[model samples]
Target: MLYKKKYSSWLHRINPALKLVLLMGGIIAVLFIHNVNVMIPLVAALAGMLLIGSGQPIGRVLLFMLPFLFVFVSTGSSMILFGKGETLWWQWGPAVISRESFYRGVHIGLRALSFGLIGLLFALTTRPVLLFYSLMQQFRLPPRYAYGFMASLRLLPLILEEFKTLQKAYKVRGVDSVKGWKGWWQKLRLYAIPLLAQSIRRAQRIAVAMEARRFNKSIQRTYYYRPGFSSEDGLMVICWVGIFAGAWIVGVQWPLFEITDVRFNE
Candidate 1:
């Protein structure tokens, strides 16, 4: 469900490890930004990148972000309704709406939106297999865990299929359906035992296969996919730096919203 069919996006060319590091830095930087004016431009930059980098149409990308938008609204609205401020716009028993709170709410919303854009940018660009493989190659990650994780991802579909088959079998065999919590517990026991047994058997088989194939953590080995940095990496770095630089310049100079520091009202 999460997989993207297209691999031609420019973002795919960037090294996963480098891309991840840069992305983490960007997210951390975003957390420090408290100004709505700053966050607005930043979010715009991210949205632009998403549209351009993902090679997706504006409509499609916006459609993808609908859920995140809902999250932004919920979080921002909560802050606006409940946040404390001296300048009151509306008052209720527990809820208070003020100019400061509204600004803060917008700031929070923009932050959330920026996060969604960043996450989607990474997801849309990075392939799961490539990500794991890149981690193993670039970071010298212990092969035991890497290959195990890859194997598990590959087996997930089969495991799910088996679970469904087992469920159907239980129904065919006239398993009694109890009511309420007991039914839930009974279902758990009935389904869990067989699946656990199968999973253990599968694990044992995989272990044997790996040992037979001489897979181990020791000794250097060549990789089928070698993730390396390129001009594109530099370009990505420049773009990231450019976005923040532009955001800070525009936000400070123009000053879109009233509140500058969202952490505290001044």
Candidate 2:
């Protein structure tokens, strides 16, 4: 399920504009936070919120996060091996490990996890239509762009279904035996050509329909659904501010670990 509706979740109840603000704010804060201790807890909190708002089982959420974990590990390992630092821990011909580099690597990995969890939370709980409506209503976004975006999202499932049908048809016609790298390339070309043509035809038809309805004729329009700020949005903002403040305070005062960025200048 790409975008499941969770009517009962608190995240769902909050306005989309507020959620968008939280998402962007969290990401920006995470970027400047270099301490692993602070990042780890932030990541955990975001993950917990995501799980709660997703209304999905813990097992499923963990399963969904496996790929992100893999990426985190890969990036961390690379940073640890290549990053430079003053306190040397291990050395080889070309690869060196240092205490600072190791900690930096861990921080990078935790940062990735924190960022990914924040994004996942937004993507899982928010609906495209709601976001569109909220943008147009609260932010005064142009209706033409908002409706076009909404239309594209609506067409996504159709495109996926068309691809699946094409795959099945090919299999039935005994042309699905392709394997290996070369065969994968061949299969991609085969699928890509038809999908491109289908998408173009669909886009043309949608454009005609929209134009017929005078979608772009006016900048002012009435919306059936209007989104507004609520108490929940206020609470969400407060909670996010507290989380960010607490993380920074603890990181600065307690000093579980220090974040050092080495820079050289002429």
Candidate 3:
């Protein structure tokens, strides 16, 4: 559902090259800012951009965020539980946890969330074909590789459909009840044989079609669509710069969200 809506929409109005630049700038800004309060503004800005650019519902946004939140929370908590620190908040003999460690974990989790949200905003709004063209034109990426990337993206849906049909056929042929870890391994190997064969066959057909069209011998090509930077792109760059500046000033000057430790002997 999300995939269909994303492609059929008018989000292609935004320039793919500009979007790549903005994502790079945002990532650089994220590297310096550690405080949740500082990060909140950045996330909010990206949220507004995604909402306006993609016209996706809040429900969709929340659904997209769910998996990333789970990943960060699980990984971050484990790190805190095993970390060593002086201000022990929880302890079971040598197995100790501290406030410092807990807060560090929280920081890591929120940072991950912020990065994930920003990236998702970009992915949801930008068409993969446009992204490929932008890379080829603006980033000077090799055209052959760009075309290959686009082909892979285009093939994914069809490939998944084929796999689904293959799975159904396998189930009907008395290959049922693959339940646990060992079952998963058995299923993968069983599926792998047919999948690999189908993939090779598909590749051969595609190569032949490309070769018949003289695809490789062509040095110059024409694009149906050309991407251009707009005023909105400038605004986005400025916003990213401002966030980094504010974060640096606030963090260095007043310490708005400081986490530090003091040692003592009693």
Evaluate all candidate structures by whole-model CA lDDT and list the values in order: 0.84, 0.78, 0.68
The digit string of per-residue lDDT tens for model 2 on 1-266 reads 44665334777777887789788988987877766767766776777777776676678778788888987998798778888777899998778888877888888888888888877778777877888889888887777788887887788898899999999998888885557998989988879999889988998899889989987654668778888878988888887887778777766667666553322112
Q: Note the residue pairs that clash in candidate 2.
A: none
Per-model TM-score versus the true fold: 0.90, 0.87, 0.81
| lDDT, residue 140, model 2 | 76
Top lDDT model: 1
Model 1, which residues run further than 4 Å from truth? 176-193
Question: Cα deviation of 61 in candidate 2 (Å)?
Answer: 3.2
In the predicted model 3, the residue pairs found to clash are: none
Best by TM-score: 1
TM-score of 1: 0.90
What is the C-alpha lDDT profile of model 3 across 1-266, one tens digit per residue? 23334442344456787777877777876776656555545565555655665567767777887898797898678657776566788887666687667766766676787788778877777777778788877787776677766776667787789889988888899787568998989988877878878877887798778767765543677766677777776766676577566655654566534563211123
